[model samples]
Target: MKKLTLVSLLALFMAGCAKNTTDSPTMVGADRDEHGCIPSAGYQWCANTNRCERPWELAEVEGFDNTPQLFEAFCTGQ
Candidate 1:
């Protein structure tokens, strides 16, 4: 019985360690509808500034918004 419990616990722990792909967006420049507020087409949704920005622009506008880390994750492609 102890051996079975240990095996079960190990399996559960491994399962918990698995990466959750659904938690993050898919790519950096994907459509906004697909990846929430992350902008596409050389744009980024700035949460702090509460606005969109082109790559040339900084993220320090009045409504400076921020793209989710997931957006960068998507860019990294896991």
Candidate 2:
């Protein structure tokens, strides 16, 4: 019975050590959108700039409110 328990525990430990190759941690920029906007890095598609940009940063630079509506308005050149 002890041998069986020991073998079971060892099997579980080895199984835990055996991880799936594809189950690794996600790399940065892996969540980029179709326009290459990395949402994880706070980037979104900006039509006016024709590229990905962080809304808050764009608001600060372009003198617009940092709200989602304003971001959309500004990016759409409203």
Candidate 3:
């Protein structure tokens, strides 16, 4: 009985860690690339000049010289 209870608890924890596709919003605008998702703290895509920009592309536009820094900025919005 103890073993069964432990197994069930582990299963529940794993299930909770799984991603919920239904909870994620559909990707929109030109920013979408092969990744199928945009970078943002609140899942918000970057919009400039009334158009959505991909995170990588936006980083270049914002004058980030290094790819790592650009990626960090894109994800953190700093």
Best model per TM-score: 2
The 10-residue segment of model 2 with minimum total lDDT is 19-28
Flag the better candidate by TM-score, 1 or 3.
1
Q: Using lDDT, give the best candidate's number.
A: 2
Whole-model lDDT values for every prediction? 0.56, 0.92, 0.56
> What's the lDDT for residue 5 in model 1?
100
lDDT for 59 (candidate 3): 62
TM values, all candidates: 0.32, 0.77, 0.30
Which of 2 and 3 is ahead in TM-score?
A: 2
Every model: Cα RMSD to truth: 12.5, 2.5, 10.2
lDDT of 3 by residue, 1-78 (tens): 999999999999999999777755655533433444444422233323234455456666776664655655655557
Residue 55 error for model 3, in Å? 31
Which residue pairs of candidate 2 clash? none
Candidates in descending lDDT order: 2, 3, 1
Q: Over 4 Å off in model 2, which ranges?
A: 21-25
